[model samples]
Target: MLLAALIGAAGAVGAAPAAEPNTQVPAGSRHYAASGFPDRIVASPAQDAGSGFAVAWRTAPLAQPPLLELAVAGDSPDMGQVQQLRASSQALQTENGDSQHHRVLIDGLQADTLYAYRVQGQGSWSAWQHFRTAAAAGEPLTVLYFGDTQNKNLSHVSRVIRQGWQSAPDARLTLFAGDLVSGGDGEDDNEWGEWFAAGGWLLPGMAVAPAAGNHEYFEEFEDTPQERRVLGKHWPVTFALPSNGAAATASTTYWFDYQGLRVVVLDGTSALDLGTAKAQASWLEKVLEDSAQAWNIVVVHQPLYPLRAERDSSVLASEIRPVLQRHKVDLVLQGHDHTYGRRADDGASLPQYISSVAGPKQYRLSPQARATMKPTAEDTQLFQVLRLDDKGLRYEARTATGRLYDAFQISRDAQGGKRFSEVTEGRIPQRDCPRPVSPKGRDDRCWE
Candidate 1:
């Protein structure tokens, strides 16, 4: 495994766990505390085509406004023609402390070009970091897809993300199926800190496309008659996503195109329980109808067909499924079931559904999973790498230890029809929990 090799060679150290979920922040804990140096820097796709993108970062409150220095990457240490741009800042109060989040949307750049940028600290400038723009049309694209990293983020999920990045170092974008953190209240800044620390320096370069999960929303005023659910406070400051989605949930739902592929992200938690189903459904139909890309993919937190019986959502099946079917989206990536489940294309339809988890949390598979899902697993963490080229779209799912778990390819024929074929020759055996010989403790199931 990449992680094992790196650790053995470098004697790397793991991140210390942050504060427990929804707990009080301990005194003198610098794990999540904001400092003068910038941190949690991330890049996101802009609403426009491949010409522009957005970058965001956080730091301790600054007396003077922050600035961003940008320049086209060149061979020498001396950066020529550097452009210093002012960034917009937002003051935020969190349990970790008061901090400022800054964002800049850079535009009018050459396609398929690399650029270096750095942000101003309190009295110093940050180290130069580099990011590449989306390639021109018809260029092959590679992307990494990850399921819920909601628990044990720093301790366990860190290795999964690192291994995925090592496996696909040139991937342009990373799609996160949500429930990114265990706490929904959004007040636990430490959880967000853990998530950022888990991704480390890798987050600043690659573009991120994330969907909001139910855990991103939490009930306010608990035990009161006026209690209500609201999205976490950290989301807006953390991600500078496109605002071209449905009116009701525009902040969490959006779309971006890279090369010949278009990625559409949705807020399933808001649609199912926040009275935005009709609005999202209407917007989804319009987006799909207007899409011009060769390949289209939809990302949402809840699955249309869940692996566990209790986790099923009828609203998703009714509202989202029809739009996907009508538009013939190539793939639908989902999470929130805490297991791995996939339904390959049936040859007549276009989309194939996949739901997976990347954290340590596990849940028992539904009884029908064995009959319905060709390959399924419980108590396993996996990440997927997807490559899109002229021949077709190739997808491979690998375990946290870098072993190939599942793989398939979706290709188009001369008649423009799609076909699905699995790589069955060298795939490892399907992972499933062993049936217990006798009941023990309070439950008979293998998962708690």
Candidate 2:
């Protein structure tokens, strides 16, 4: 196992219990509170290709009038020459406290140029950070993909993300397939705080493209009786995503273009609504039809094909699968199953679908789950790296310690047909929960 693989999940099974699922404010969470310093800084893709990018951060409630300073860097940038812009801000109230979230969209940037920028609170400014804009088409790229990072966020889950970044430092963008936090309704600010802490500086350095998982949506108040789950209130203030998706889904359901790849994110939670489902399905088909990128990828929270033995998202699958099939999406990545699974489309020429988890939470595999998923794993946390080359795309799933657990390659032909092949080299055997020392933990085992 690689050193990185030794860090989380596999090793954390014996650690202290994770935060309560409904904990909006874990004990001692005051230590994690935001001060005058800017935190939870994140970079997201601008609407278009290379012309722009967006950055967002949170500050103390007393902090007002968010500001962003940016400068184009050549051999070196002169800090004094930086241009300043007032960012748009929104007020949010969470269990942690009241604070303002700010986002600034820097436009008219030269493509492929290095730029330095920083944010400011009421009286403090963050250290300068730098990022490179996307280049034109045909540039080879590597993208890091992570599944549901929804538990033990600060201590354990953060390592999973850091290890992934350490392994693929040059990756252009990071795709988080949702369930970013355990409880998304802002009931638990600690989960969000931990999530932000886990990323540290990496969150602002690399652009994050995230999907909305079930955890990202919750009943507004934990005490609400028979309340329908909705997109968490924090989502709008937390992420500044493209607004090119369905009107109902907006930021949570959006798409962006990087180099030659077009990535579309959909809200699986909304699919439960018949009206919204049809609208998203229609919008998806239109987006696919309009896309000119060489690659099209779809990301959603619930797997169209569930990986659990007793669970299935057939309604969502029925609504979206046809659109995916008609569009010939290259890949479909998902979360919410809390297990690892991969299945090719029925025709084998359609999208290659996969679902995985990346937090300390673990689930067992049943005979039905085993029978449905060809390559599946239980009680394991994993991260995947995908490299897009001239010929095709190569994917590898590795443990936190850097052990290779699963891999495959998708090759595209001159006729636009995709050929999927599993790369068995360096792949580790599927993992099952080990026998526990305590009889009370038997239910957690992946194997009987």
Model 1, position 208: C-alpha lDDT score? 87
Task: Give RMSD to native, each candidate.
Answer: 5.3, 4.6
Best by lDDT: 1
Model 1 lDDT-worst window of ten? 437-446
lDDT per model, in order? 0.83, 0.79
- C-alpha TM-score for every candidate: 0.90, 0.90
Give stretches of model 2 more than 4 Å off: 1-28, 62-64, 74-77, 184-187, 220-226, 273-275, 436-448
- lDDT by residue for model 2 (96-121), tens: 67788899888898887778889998
Model 2, poorest ten-residue lDDT window?
16-25
Model 2 per-residue lDDT at 420: 77
Error of 2 at 10 (Å): 16
